[model samples]
Target: MTFTYTVSPKDWLGIAPIVVLVVMALVLMLVDLVLPHAGERSKHTGPANFTVLPAVGLLGVLGAMAAAVTLFFVDHPTSVFNNMLGADAGTLYADLIILAAGGLGILLSPAYLKRLKLVHQGEYYALLLLSMTGMLLMAGALSFLIVFVGLEMFSLALYILCSFIDKRQTSQESGMKYFLLSSFASAFLLYGIALIYAATGHTSFVDVQKFVVAQAHGHAPILLLVGLGLLTVGFAFKVSAVPFQAWTPDVYQGAPAPVTAFMSIGTKVAALLAFMRVFGFALSSVQSSWMPVVWAIAVLTVILGNLMALGQSNVKRLLAYSSIAHGGYLLIGVVVSGAAQQNHIGASAVLFYLTCYLFMNIGAFGVVSLLERIDNTGSDLSDLRGLWYRRPLLAGLLAFFLLSLAGFPPMAGFAAKYYLFYAALVGGHPELLIIGVVASVLGIYYYLRFIATMFMEGREGSHASSTHAAFERIPATPRPTRAPTGSLTRAASSTRGATAVAEKPASTKIAASPLPATAEIEPTHELEGWSWVALGIAALGTLVTGVILPFWLPQLQQAAQSLLK
Candidate 1:
């Protein structure tokens, strides 16, 4: 009694990553609240906080990432804390992806926060770290308590992040909408967990799986089955599966681009991890009951997500729908993982796809964020009319990312898609493979259309009139004026009426003297230093992932195999 300790250093080491992140978040917030601002500019974008907080936040992410990698090789059981949280290789893999997204988001944040004159730099980075921490907890959750705690923790942080731009009404709407919908989903998940515990007398995943295995197929209690169904709803909502994806486009479009750049990928990684655990392993014995439901949702999401993305003029909204479609692709792996004898292959595909997606998706969103910072014009198609002529490097980058997203050959996206679809065929789900391929083909149209818009120039005569008209919206001043978020959707409709009202003679007069290429638009090659670095790294990741497919596949396969145990 005198010498023994209840909580030892080894126990803390079990959750070393979470501890590092939580401590970092607390330190940043305390520094922000305690530090004094001596000047007007410092009050909003404090020199101290802005410069140091993001760097600190990035450091925290890297530290946690390193800790996760360490946990992978440590000579300890994967499950720690009485099997409440798992430091399994699968969870560690998901944590790395979440942290990668957060690091990139931090890199993209400085300019966005400064440009918007947002205060609370400490809270911003702190919340981001906390969110990443929660995602890690959720991914590694071994008990229902940890799952709900992790879910609520991340959800609360995201609500604040979503409405961080309080000056914009749309941000408020996005936050409120997400809060309502997500809470409802969480309730379903919690209720389901309770039912399962009541039916099986176990709240831990391993115990629950043991109970399920003991019960003969189709003989499981009704309450346990219902609980499983409810869990699916919660996970489905998180992944933005169809019929539950209404919040995605608006939230992605309304949230600060930096936040979207991270949330779009990180959230999926966490949700899918929990989903695979609960469905692919814990409840696999009863897979015959749930596979049909998941299969249907996956097909619907793939078809509808691409179809909805086809007409989106807003790049963020387009990417949001694109995200929903990718979710469907990820789900295919989940469904196939339930297919007997193909568990490892299907699960591994999901991990590899997520690794590829983290780079390509964030890079695409970063370019959009850059355009927003530069011109306050990324929210519309008109902003992209002659992007290639205006910013060749940026246009080229966007083109490469879009092609990767489109699954063009030799890009990571193609390799990712290839593995996920191939898993379906290996799992005896040829129908899912067929449906996914067809939907991917449909998605290529919109992606290529975006690339074409960016790479191809418009007619010279039209540039003087139409392009000049579009240019009028961009301010020449150093600090551009702010407008309500999502105003473009409304303005686009009004522009149709105004287009008819404009005099033909004024347009003809402008077209007579077409602007020369030299003076078309000032070059904006000089982006913020950190943003350029983030984009450069993302570009390298996008290309290198595809190029080094052979190298990483074994690691992912090894990670995926851990989930089955």
Candidate 2:
């Protein structure tokens, strides 16, 4: 027996998106080494190239996205690289979603990192790009080996990203917990892969499909059955399904908001796509064996996840549970796609919903990331009270995203859920649709609750302390227009006189304390330029995807046709 090997330019072209990202990650770290003020930046004492590193990362993501889009025009087989990768339309589509998430997540990062005084600029962007590469790899995987490798690659990057804020204990805890639990989940998935290899003597999806179809009884063997169950547990944890979701709220709450923002879409898109490829396509011949278990997880995750989210006061935790529930909604696609009879409706709906979700969900987390101050403060319900009064733009955007997440009409979230539920109904899973709608209704109360807090007349707190709560209660004063030269001279003279007096004596300080040069007023910080870019794109996407979904739906459905066959 011989294991044939060959490398072609076309093979590299098939994985061009991944290759671009890997190159960019290394380039970013190297670029950081040569930037001005590198030593001061590392020590957190001077000006840093806050603009350059994130910009480089964004360009890399854009490049990867371009590579992925180019693959749409290239003719490629279902599997490439010795049957380890997929270059089909579905893989390309999923790659676009993952890249979109990575791009938006990078846009949200620089400001958050700066605000938190996290000065590790180079490694941060590098890991982010590397993480996106892993997601792209997972999206294109056709073999169990590639899937596990991709999972670990992305998961390891995320573990470090989650703990990047050295000043925060919560961040460290989040990273550690994610490392431990994810490793445990990886073990289950890997063991399942090993058992499947033993049973079928293959690891590629094509080979596994052939072996499963060749089985005599139209049923799975006991070993294959156990392996499938373990596979379910592992993927279930990855998707944050119920009974395996305890880590989600904790990790989401503890990690930095931008990291949470990225993982919400990136991790789910990668994990669910792989899950769909494995169960919905590869082992689809044994659909009767795995569908019931996936169906059960979906139902519980949809219902229980919503129930858990109803009481969260912290913005991150609320979104975490929301992410978990949405994961269940996405699983409906997997459950239904197992039936080759309905064509690829489930897979297409998954793709379409993922596109919509990337906008609405990331925008919501982007706002949270933008709002976070020192030590990860300013994300509580109390901090959001009267937010509309303080930052109407942010408040309005949050409402729009929350409404979308709640499946309200006219928002992308509504459109995403509609297509997903339609797929469930069309695929003969009416029960999932019914349960999902009920859970979504439960979800609305929390989203709306947070919205209500933002719109409150004033944040509920006293003015004794100079905290964000009190800051929200204060009416924003209009900044006065610049004065003429003569008036400015007079004002400057008066300010100097007052400062001189305040510095002179303790008795003069009593009268001029607020006017003292050292006395500082808490600034009503403006949204960072990069964050505005992210929010603008997200807002536009949230609106446009819903409005244009009808046009795009058919195109996505055509891409999904490959999976069901």
* Candidate with the greatest lDDT versus the true structure: 2
**Model 2 misplacement above 4 A:** 38-48, 340-342, 461-527, 551-555, 563-565
Candidate 2 — which pairs collide?
Answer: none
Model 1, range 1-565, lDDT digits (tens) per residue? 3544366566678788899999889887776766667876575455666677888898898889889899878876677787888877777778889999999999988867765556777888999999998998998899888998999999999999998877667777888889999999999999988988899998999999888888745556788878888988999999999989999999998888899999998789989888888888778888888889999999999999999999988788989999999999999999988884444788789988999999999999998887762222455665576788777888899889989998987888999998898889888999999999999999999988877777675534464546455643432221222435643343333321222111231242111111121211333233267788888889999988888874676666655665635
Best by TM-score: 2
lDDT against the true structure, per candidate, is 0.80, 0.81
Angstrom error at residue 522, model 1: 15
Least accurate 10 contiguous residues by lDDT in model 2: 499-508
Q: Estimate each model's TM-score.
A: 0.87, 0.88
lDDT tens per residue, model 2, 182-292: 999999999999998988999988889898998825689989998888888888998999889999988998888888889889999999988998998888888888888
Candidate 1: residue 408 lDDT (0-100): 89
